[model samples]
Target chain A: MTTTALKARKEFGKTLASDIAHRLRNEIVTCQLKPNESLKFDALRLSFGASFTTLREALTLLAAEGLVVAEEQRGYKVAPVTLEDLHDLTHARILIEVDLMRRSIEKGDDDWEIRVISSLHRLARIEERAPEDYASNTEWKAAHRQFHEALVSASGSPTLLAVRNSLFDRAERYRNLSAMFRPHPRDKAGEHRALMQAAIGRNADQACNLIASHIQTTSNNVAKYASGVISAG
Target chain B: MTTTALKARKEFGKTLASDIAHRLRNEIVTCQLKPNESLKFDALRLSFGASFTTLREALTLLAAEGLVVAEEQRGYKVAPVTLEDLHDLTHARILIEVDLMRRSIEKGDDDWEIRVISSLHRLARIEERAPEDYASNTEWKAAHRQFHEALVSASGSPTLLAVRNSLFDRAERYRNLSAMFRPHPRDKAGEHRALMQAAIGRNADQACNLIASHIQTTSNNVAKYASGVISAG
Candidate 1:
């Protein structure tokens, strides 16, 4: 191939790989792909209409995000969810995310507040259903992520946000598992509204407290339910 | 190729890629590769005796670790070191590593204590010279890293340790920069000995404080010296 065509083709490959990674990430996070499931390339290639190289690249991205596990001399598997994993993720989030939220409250401008209000509205409008029902509800999932991210949008530290985001994405599987076994519907809207008020009101302590509880509650529910279904150690 | 030959070739490629990745990681972290310097494929291929495919695979791995930045169609560069990045990494280490050290102290058994003492001894035996000298001193670097990791090896949470490890590594580049511009050599050994005493003594609060200060001191020194060197934004 000519240099120009080769460069263009390489760019196309990068975009295609990223697109496939996003698709696979959503599936894995929502439990549609399921935990500890082997991700055979042939099946994934057929499903995504991607080449082997593209599929491998996509899996590499997911592996970096901790959503997929790459084994030496073996293929990839969806990362397993365990009670210990959930607790670790929860503790990291409480420490990092709460600090981010406090910083956001201290540093945020009017635009950040506006984003918090609007994202919350978007999420509040979506129906918060059970895990099985919401598994395919990408819109609600996106809105929920936006709302949480918007709260800390002005933390002004890209590294902190990236760390917070990875922990958030890794914990998502457990949230689905938690919802799957929840005996009663959580008043997520109410909780989010409280968090939003505290954040915009500049009550950093209260905002941090609410987010910690919000994280801890999901963690508790997941451990209570998933302990029996997955590895305890 | 036969199926077995193909499988063997694939396994060989994986190992070669990982080896290249490690080599590149050490160079980038130690700043031998230099921050924001272009990593052209042809030069890297010649230098590492790697094929284009193998080099790309290695770059992908380094990208996952935040040591390499891949530009679409253009190739890669060593990840940049900015004051903001240093602060973000240092803040992360303070919160996460201190927490890990605290937990390791609480949960660590006799082996953890022995490892900490031995690693400290190993580190102290080596010369903690200037950055330019220590840049080539992989032994001292390895011992230093082992000493810190050993202090938190029993945090009982793989996820937490993984996060801590990443933060620690990303901060390494800045530590080298800090040492490069130091007006006087720091008593890192003394600080580390104190930290070890606090950790093995089960004084979580003291250990955490020592680590936070050690991390903060490096961060402040780097900011003071390198403020005029790199990107401010």
Candidate 2:
């Protein structure tokens, strides 16, 4: 084959591998794959209808993101969750998030402010439409993520934003698990509104403090539910 | 094969993959593998005497660590260094390290204190022996890492520590590059000694400020040298 043809084939292979990884990532985070379950290559090949090479590449990508664990002899497994890990994750998130928010408030322009307000409005609408509907929970979660991202979008440091994004994804997985096992009723909408207000008012200290408490409450709830789920299992 | 035998074989494969990853990580950070250089699998497989599968797994792990970039059709390449990225990295490190130091000071036990002193002593001795000996630079780098790790060992938060570790490794690469290109001399020993003294005195504010400045100075120097190197190349 000519060099151009070879290059094209390689590019296609990479895109396919990435697509597989993205699908698997979604499944793992949504708990469809279940934590700690070994990802047998043959089974994944059959399920995804991809070659071993493609599946292996996909798994490796997920492993890099900490969504999957590359077991020494056992191939890969969906990363397990625990109360301690959840607490630690939450703690780190609070630190990075609050710091980013403070920077965002200090440096964010009008565009950043508008995005935050719009995201909050969208999130509130989603929650109001179906706060407890499992069918629409995914939409609500997406909106929630957007709202949080918007609040800190003006940090202007890609490194901080990247760290915040990773932590947010990890927390999202636990949040999803929490909703699954224990459907607790809480004033999430009210809390987010207050967070938005504080951020918009340029009250960095108050906004950060509110975010800390906001994250802490969710973590406590998730931890309580996660433990119960583990014990029952 | 029986289940046990099959498991053993799988374990060996995983170990081989991990070993390859470790070897590549060292090379990338030390600039043995130049940045933006494509990691052609065929060549790597030949050089490492490993199969394509094993080599690919290794590259993916490095990619996950941000030391390597997995290109679409071109395969993997060592991540390129830029002054902007370096600055962002330093900023993130300052925030995390200082916060961690504050916590460490508040909670570090006597054992933690002893470890910090020991690490500092070892690092100081290494610097004094050969401040400019490129041959033993790796040893010096390891000592420097240990000293920093020891200072924050009492943070009591694994997540924060993990993030800090990743950022530290990234910065280490830039430092190595800076030394290779510029080879400037500085009072690194004095700075580290003062840092250790502040921590040992339980002066959180002073220690944190010192660390922030220490990191900033290195970053500034590295940036200046890195830009020159890049332009020269």
Candidate 3:
């Protein structure tokens, strides 16, 4: 093969690996793959219609992101959920997210303000829709992530943002798990609006306080429901 | 094979993969593997006496730790350093480390205090041996890491420590790079002593202030040297 042909093949392989990782990540986070369940290589390859190399690469990537755990000779398994993990994750998230919000308030420009507002609007609209509708729930989750991302977009620190993003994703898995077990009625809309108002008002102290409480409340709810589910199972 | 024999073989594979990852991580952080240089799998497999699968898994693990970067089409490469990265890293470190130190002071027991003093003693001894000796420098780095780790060991948050450890390793790479380009004389020993004093005194604010300044001074120096090294290269 010519150099160009080899390069194209390599590129295709990389893309294929990334695509498979994305799909697998979604499955794991949505609990479709189920937590703590062993992931058999041959089964995953057949299910994803991917080559062995591609599937292995995808799993390795997920393992790096903590969505999957690489076992010795046992192959990979979906990362398990526990209250301790959630507590640690929540504590770390509060630290990073609060700091990022403070920096964002100090450095965020008009664009950042607009992004926050737009995300808030979108999320509120989705919340008004059927809260139990799976599709709308997914949309709500995405909008929620967008709003949080916008809140920290102007932290002007890539490292902070990256750390915050990772913590956010981990916490998300627990949140999703909790949602499945117990659909509690809460005024999420009011809380988010308060958060938005503080952020836009450029009250770093208030914003940080709001965010901490917001995260802690969700964490408490998730912990309660997740424990119930685990104990019942 | 018997079940025990099969288990042993599986354990061996896991150990080999972990060993390779550890060795590669050291090389990357120490600049034995140059930053941004492509990690050719064939070359690495030949050098490490490992199979392609083992080597890939090792690389994937390092990529997760941010010690290596996985590029599309291209393969893994040592994560590169830039001024922007340094700034962001330092900022995040200050936020996390200071908060951790505060918690450590508030929550630390006598044992934690003993560990901090012990680590400081070891580091100070190492510093006195040879501040610039290449062979002893590695020992100094290890001791330094230990001292800092001890300072935050009482934070009581595993997630915080994990994030802090990753950031610490990345910063070490930059410090190593700066040491190569420019060796400035600073009373690092005294700074560390003051830091230790504050911590033992249970003065959270003072300890945090000392650490923040200490980190900032090193950051500024490293930034100055790193920019010159990059530009010259």
TM-score for all models, in order of appearance: 0.89, 0.87, 0.87
Instruction: Flag regions of model 2 displaced more than 4 Å.
Output: A1-14, A131-136, A230-233, B1-14, B131-136, B230-233
DockQ, 0 to 1 scale, candidate 2: 0.57
Task: Name the docking class for model 3.
Answer: medium
Candidate 3 chain B has its poorest 10 consecutive residues by lDDT at B5-14
> What lDDT does each candidate get?
0.81, 0.83, 0.83
Question: Under CAPRI classification, how is model 2 graded?
Answer: medium
Q: Please compute DockQ, using alpha carbons, for every candidate against the native two-chain complex.
A: 0.46, 0.57, 0.54
Q: Residue A167 CA error for candidate 3 (Å)?
A: 1.5
Q: Model 2: how far is B158 from its true place, Å?
A: 2.2
Task: State the lDDT of candidate 3 residue by residue for A179-202, as single tens digits.
Answer: 777756456788889988998999
For DockQ, the strongest prediction is 2
In candidate 3, what are the lDDT values of residues B1-233, reduced to their tens digit? 56785445334245677778878888888888988888999999888777887888788778877889988767889887778778888998999999899999999999999999999999888867776653227787888899999999998887788778888988888888887877555568888899999999998999999999989998998888778754332
Tens digits of per-residue lDDT for model 1, B25-100: 7788777888999999899988887787778777877787788888877788998888777877777778788878
**Lowest lDDT 10-residue stretch of candidate 2 chain B:** B5-14
Q: Is the docking of candidate 1 incorrect, acceptable, medium or high quality?
A: acceptable
Clashing pairs in 1: none
